[model samples]
Target chain A: MTPRPQQEPTCHGEDYAPFERALLNDYQHELPLVPRPFAAIGEQLGVSEQAVLEALQRFREQGVLSRVGATLKPGAVGAATLAAMGIPERDLEQVAAIVSARPEVNHNYEREHELNLWFVAMAADDAALRAALTAIENETGYPLLDLRLVCDYHLDLGFDIQWTSANETDA
Target chain B: MDVSERDRRLIGALQAGLPLVRRPYAVIGEAVDMSESEVLRRIAALRDAGVIRRFGVIVRHHELGYRANAMMVWAVPEHQVDSLGERVAESPQVTLCYRRRPAPPQWPYNLYCMVHGRDRETVLAVRDELVARHGLEGMEHRVLFSGRRFKQRGARYLAPKQEAIGREANHGRA
Candidate 1:
């Protein structure tokens, strides 16, 4: 892992308007499944439909919000597994690029360990998943640790944003 | 449960995200040649079928100041995994929890959960509380803090080439 840098903690919410904060904090899930969903959200947020739409657009452009869409259950539409590889420090970048380029590989990270490069691989089926992992192994010339999930105990609730802690509101 | 061809098209259209328009479903319907009502119905059906686990705003935690995260893995007794995993997952501090196949002789930790906080000290404190609260003190565990993130994006169930383009267009990351 990269050593933790000594720096002042950034207050991410310093620039966000209350409406923007509410949109992010309150709507992580349970979006109204309606023809005019944004309008519905606007009703709850006490803003016009246009305001809601405009705010989301800005959030997207700023990369603060990923999307307003479905998060598919892992292995529901396809097979998936958590995979890791022990890449030599010198070659981590090259090997990581290869893994990241493959769209099948998602959530790739360099962790603080011998098996540093970790990622999640997904495909249409078990066979396709194996083939993808095998190709990565052959290309990278490193054995992969295929950790298939046995159970997902965490409910699908979205991550709760600690708004007060994340912001310097008093300042 | 098989996903229909139309459902696949819907998923493809949605992989980017719902457009920030008044009638976003109408926009999506136009893309897949689905009626606005039909699109909404399909989305609900998909959700009910457990295909769509969540449907709403997806925030980037790192950008939101929940930067420090650690993947905590524990090797608990086989019989106690289900009970312990449920407890760990129930903790609000733990963002993700799963029982994974442990690579034995080398990696013997099967239970996995992730804790995220604004900084390292907060993350470690959360882990400690979880460990103590769950009676997992004696268990063999390791906390693997995340380092450089190479790539992070939503799962691409469709062709990689197509979704990669859409991913970049939407700035999509999980």
Candidate 2:
């Protein structure tokens, strides 16, 4: 299929206001190590265990919630990274299929610009991840511009759309 | 927020905690006074809506011994972003890929994507393939690897009217 220029906002729900940002917030604490943690939270929210369960179902039913499982730090357990590519218009689909077929690749996105492709890599470690990149380079005949993360001034995004760092003088 | 009362109770519990026992549903039933089957059905509904993305283990990459990681950003041609994105994300190495309004002047590329691997070498190999396969010869990309992890966890689900509950999403893993 012929690819066309398109912009997809991942932070969708722009058409309609988010039902409540709070529901998506508050993961700072450890998940209840015990069984029936939901029951515990239900007591605090002044609702029934059933209510908590169903509400999550509904948020997911709507496009508000993304996942209800644990968010483990991939870096600690394994290795991962982010990268992008510059593909021609005609061969994007073929490339996408090939890329997704790999186990290491995960997040993928399309943008509007010269280097219009971007994605994240979560491999078991640095060597493995680099090896994967090399294999890709060999197949595609293009050197990947590896821009490793230097510092993350802001890591936790999305939840606090209105959050501002202490050094808000510049923006 | 607009869920039925029954749903409210179920969600409330889920938001608080999920049973980690063999019969998690049974424990949940005791709290909400519903059958395990009922709880499972409700979860299925949420997943269908793209709200509850899934019920799986949140992997701790570093703990799993994966040290090298970066946020690889790409700059594909505007016409090929979608197809390219699908391909880039196709690799299980990638965890996220969508679209972002690139920062002007500072950030030239608009199309953003990701790929995760064991180390820098593995990731670079896959990236190189895309570069050549897609014919991206002259493009800028940054593979920003993480040195410190401030926080990371499942996305919080807050309604529009409520105050977002901010928690320290990621704990120490060093």
C-alpha RMSD of each candidate structure in angstroms: 5.2, 18.3
Fraction of native A-B contacts kept, per candidate = 0.84, 0.04
lDDT per residue for candidate 2 within B94-172, as digits (tens), equals 5555544344444655555455555789768877887777666687776656443322333222221110111111111
lDDT value for model 2 = 0.48
Whose TM-score is greatest here?
A: 1
Q: Positional deviation of A168 in candidate 1, in angstroms? A: 8.4
TM-score of 1: 0.90
Question: How many angstroms is residue A93 displaced in model 1 relative to the true structure, after the best TM-score fit?
Answer: 0.5
Measured by DockQ, the strongest candidate is 1
Q: Give i-RMS (Å) per prediction.
A: 1.7, 15.3
Cα lDDT tens digits for candidate 2, A80-170 = 5556566775765555555555545555545444554555555545787788777776766544555454222122222222212211543
TM-scores for all candidates?
Answer: 0.90, 0.44
